[model samples]
Target chain A: MKPTPTPDFDKNHPDRAAANLATHAHALFAIASEHIDSDTLRRLRAARSDALSAPRRRNLLPVLVPAGALAAAVLALAVVWHPLHAPSTAPATAGTGAMLVSADSSEVDMAQNLDFYDWLATQPQPASAASAQ
Target chain B: MNLAAVPQHSEGLVAARAPELPVTLETFLAQVQRRAFRVAEMGLGNVDDALDAVQDAMLRLHQHYRQHPAQEWSPLFWGILRRRITDLQRRRKVRSIVVGWLGSVGDDGEGGPVWEPADPLADPAREIAGRAAYADLARAVRALPRRQREAFMLRVLEGLDVADTARAMGCSDGSVKTHLSRAMEALRHKLEDWK
Candidate 1:
């Protein structure tokens, strides 16, 4: 294509020069765009077809993200709360003396021996007992 | 304000509310693809990259905004193309930087492949001149700041109105005018010899 003739504009006039430039540049660009090689045009056509046929990205991220975050928070809370509030297998020592019931027989014997000691203390010492000690 | 009392304004509101005539997405893409490719080419300075950017823009528009009003497709498509071009340009910049740092000779950093126009003119001399002119213009355009290049291409070459150009560039109308003015001034100086 013949390049568009540069318009007759005063070279010193900025406005006219700009107008001529816009016109000339636009013409050139239009020619270039319209006369794209057949190979490139074919590629462009194929690209368009591919774009149309390509599956739309099902952006589930927007919906899934918040839900996933929420689920994670709930799971973490469950994890934390379970250990804190779970029923204990060990005996409760807060209000009941039931803990002593589960103790070894030796501990029970020790408790019984405490009563014998108390009785021994209560027995007043005789004058003979005192001299023998 | 009693909206019903303003008949003209009410009519305009009703018109605005009226559903736009349906234009198929395929038709819209076809209509803008060539011009979009040109715009991308101008911005990217490489034909293949330009084509890639255009295709990417088309796919994104189809994927995300197919349900939008047809009247809005022009700005939306152009906006997508503009962003895609920016991304490609940025990638090229980073690649050039990496290539330079690595001391690789593969990329000369001298503006990747040049586009050779397929001129069918019987007069070889005229064809050469035409190609030279186009090359000169493209070079000057590529030299522009990113915003100015976008404004010039969208406003002048692609012939988008100020509003649509602003939308495509993600700027205000006044900003578009400012960018376009600066671009023109720059081009005027660079292309003075052509005039």
Candidate 2:
């Protein structure tokens, strides 16, 4: 007599067949786990710890970096705007011109040429006279 | 300098963000490490290679994708492991091919088979039938082709859903199904007496 054909238990269901195979495969996998003995397991754990620690250390940089940038930006804004607004109570010796000269070295050259500018102011009627005529 | 003096970084924020971060990652890696190593062993057929693959995968996942949501960790880590295992498998294949070529030159019976592992089942040692059968199963699974092994491990052993397995293996759902079916059929045939 002919035997009956087995039903398609795994048909239309991939994981079913996979599950069956896994069921069969699990025992050997367990044995294989045993083969991954203590020393190996320890190393694997150490590897995990090593791997874990690296990212945490790396993560510190990102946190520190953005915060550091924010602080630097805030400090810079304060330094720049501090003398600009000056609370109207800054020392008279620390005049805005002197502050500008300190803030920009180019202003030192302008300040140093102030005497020349004053002499020129007393002597510069040539161009204005020609234009007036 | 004063930036260093006050320490501009938010110590509180760092403490808040960091404490929770690696805990989940470490848990995930710890949970999966053994099984991942097992799967790699199945693929590579050697403990060292398998552990290397596992460690590389772990490092890659931690270094690259730790910030992904916890739920996404499974697929991402598996995906990385899949790639690492595949890469190592390819490199092994190339090395074996070169070795085979060199061996073929002498054409002597000196070197044994390069692919097949030693039969641990040969020595029974009064072990249980289940253990012996498991040895056979591991050998059989290792004997399977690379794609079939990957499909089997991911879809079956790892219990990833088809979509997740597909994502992990970098293949289409249909391809995953096909490979998994072929793997199951092959394993069933090879391990017919296990039941």
Candidate 3:
């Protein structure tokens, strides 16, 4: 017949078991520490430094950086494209006429352009009058 | 001076004015390198990986010592070494995120941890015997699962308390407890068999 496991070695005995194990475990660690040498330690430090620094030591920024910059540039262009390319709010016909009026502000030029101004002044009255009545 | 000469002179000036730091980088390595290596070896099983991990941690320590206080180096070294070991465990496929999560959720709350402080100098004979026992324990510890081994070495061998071990291992106190408990169980079974 197979031997039945002892119930006495249950949770209650964990403390005693742990203590005994620790005692032996501690001894094992000391012996291992003794086998280790200064040179081995020095070598480990060197290897650790190399491994930790591997992620940062690089020269790929030039190749990788431009792609990110191009993406950002594209995104920026997309955001501003609509605002920049949208047509002006001014009445399309008024823009060229206003540019012409502003270009020559001399008394003689204004006197010559009085008809254009008069026509512009007359254009807005119809919209305002329609709104009022 | 010519533009080239001016640039050269500035470089020379910066080099001349550089701090004669009390702890030279090489000297610092010489000071803490071995202990750090031993800590790494004990914390992470597999001497080869431990060596690599310790070297990596030492390099980081050397690279950053100027930014940190000298006294804080030990804990910082441990913190970094633990990170390296975790990375190694990940690469070796010995530990999975699922296992770590399960271990964390299973910790028993004893209101405090079970590992206690014992006097090292008070009992020389006992200390010697304990040291021998620790050697065997270290091998058993190395055989444990990565998380359990980490918790065991950090809390027990490195003499770090639970909170410190938790910080080093990047896990909860509960997780540390669970790992430690499992580690203790494995050690007991293995040691009993060996004796």
Candidate 4:
């Protein structure tokens, strides 16, 4: 004999289905919670602490060398250019022709003015009356 | 020299400034680690790989948490973890391709087959019937589309509310509801035997 096909209970009783589902879900959750391992919990605690502390000690070694080199190059250029570009120490000695002669010394001459030489060199040259041979 | 005097002033200024900020990575990890592990495990279907994904996600979170907002940390962490799991899936696919190309290596044959975890609640006639029903339910859940699976896990397993689940999943609450509804329908069909 052909068995009567089961009615679609979900159509007639949605609330009943939902309540059962919720109950089953709650039971599943309770079971799953019991299986939570203490070791896993400890490991999780460690991972979190590591995550927080790791940034404080973060050393991006991959980028450090290139960044350091670039910074050093910039700093060296600044050091070299600073004295040469600064305003001269005294205005009275500004136009003296001896400034350029002393500018070649590698040793820093605190008393001598490299800026005066730089200023002097930057000035527009006089229109030469005679052509150079 | 004034230059020598400048160092002291700078040092004093630094001391007077606020202390280094205490990042809450540890605290956040304590809250999310287990759920993250479970989510990863469900997504990848491998405990060791899931653990690795969780660790990698935690490390990445640590790396970025300083710049990330305090309130958005949970969502941001979950997003990073999801990405890590995706990466792991891609890597597994590549490994499979490589293995297939290489004609495969011999298994170590040491460890036993994938151990079936016996449901502790699987006993007695009523419980046995429940177990079979639950098995069908689990299979239905496992068969869900990726987004639906994620939505269900976030909303149901993690017990996150709709707004929070939406934030974590990077979707609207409506999307969460849609995914959840589809998941529920699929499970309901599979779980009809439970009636």
Best by DockQ: 1
Higher-scoring candidate on DockQ, 2 or 4: 2
Per-residue lDDT tens digits for candidate 4, residues B106-125, read 36544332333334223211
* DockQ metric for all predictions: 0.18, 0.11, 0.10, 0.07
For all candidates, what are the clash counts? Answer: 0, 0, 25, 0
**Interface RMSD of predicted model 1:** 14.0
Q: Is candidate 2 or candidate 4 better by TM-score?
A: 2
The TM-score, computed over Cα atoms with residue i paired to residue i, of candidate 2 is: 0.58
Off by over 4 Å in 4: A1-19, A56-133, B1-24, B66-70, B104-139
Clashing pairs in 1: none
Specify the CAPRI tier of model 4.
Answer: incorrect
TM-score, predicted candidate 3 vs. hidden true structure:
0.48
Tens digit per residue, CA lDDT, model 3, B129-169: 24444444555666788888877776655555567678777
Chain A TM-score relative to the true structure, per candidate: 0.48, 0.32, 0.28, 0.27
TM-score of chain B of each: 0.75, 0.74, 0.55, 0.64
Q: Model 1 residue B104 lDDT? A: 46
DockQ of candidate 3 is 0.10
* Cα error, candidate 4, residue B14 (Å): 49
Candidate 1 — which residues are off by over 4 angstroms? Answer: A1-14, A61-133, B1-22, B104-129
Sort every candidate by TM-score, greatest first: 1, 2, 4, 3
